[model samples]
Target: MNYQPSQNDIVNEYIENLSAEIAPLFLEIRACILEAGPEFNESIKWKNCLVYGTTKNHIQTVVGKGKISLIFHDGVAIEDAYGLLEGDGKKARTVRITSPDFNRAALQDYVRQILQRS
Candidate 1:
């Protein structure tokens, strides 16, 4: 798929090296986030994590053994109507994806809300 022009090469490498077990789910989540907010750019942060944003970081992707965690940087401000967001940190919330059939609608909603806020 044609992604945004701002896509970073380093982030591309990171996604390319993802384990077979989580790559599909990670790609799906990446597609969902990009589709929901086409203006966002991708980059690798903290040496390993993939982060998405416009001018500043908004969402962070953390890969785990068998799951992927999407961390909304300003998640505290986004509406959680679907109750999919987790965490009680000062400003971040996470959505854990473990399977291919994750909640796309809710994920898209969160992405849109973050875009609107930005």
Candidate 2:
């Protein structure tokens, strides 16, 4: 697979294709983050999707050329506060995977807490 990404760019055109399968889910996820607080900002970062909190970025999609990666950033660094969210990154402090499966409530809880703490 060949990919050409400009410096500091994460959302390539490839990621836009995921909107068909991931946008609906992404909307739900965004809602969850918004419900957490008013500080979180939903914007396109790295040309991909990103949810920004005041102190730090809360969530950002890692969807790449042929794979998707959703990182929880500092939120996942919290000890077992990810609302029983399941994924390859379950064990790691932060989540790094290429799947659309996510625990909406758990993810919401995570955003809420991180925004509160940060």
**C-alpha TM-scores of all predictions:** 0.92, 0.56
**Pairing residues by index, what is the TM-score of model 2?**
0.56
Q: What is the lDDT of residue 17 in candidate 2?
A: 51
Candidate 2 residues lying further than 4 Å off, grouped into runs, are 1-18, 64-69, 81-92, 95-102
Pairs clashing in candidate 1?
none
Q: Candidate 1, residues 32-54: lDDT per residue as tens digits?
A: 89999888888888869988999
Q: How well does candidate 2 score on lDDT at residue 93? A: 39
Q: lDDT for model 2, please.
A: 0.52
Cα lDDT tens digits, model 2, 20-90, are 65545544444555676656544566654564546666667654453444466664455555445334554
Best by TM-score: 1
Candidate 1 TM-score to native: 0.92
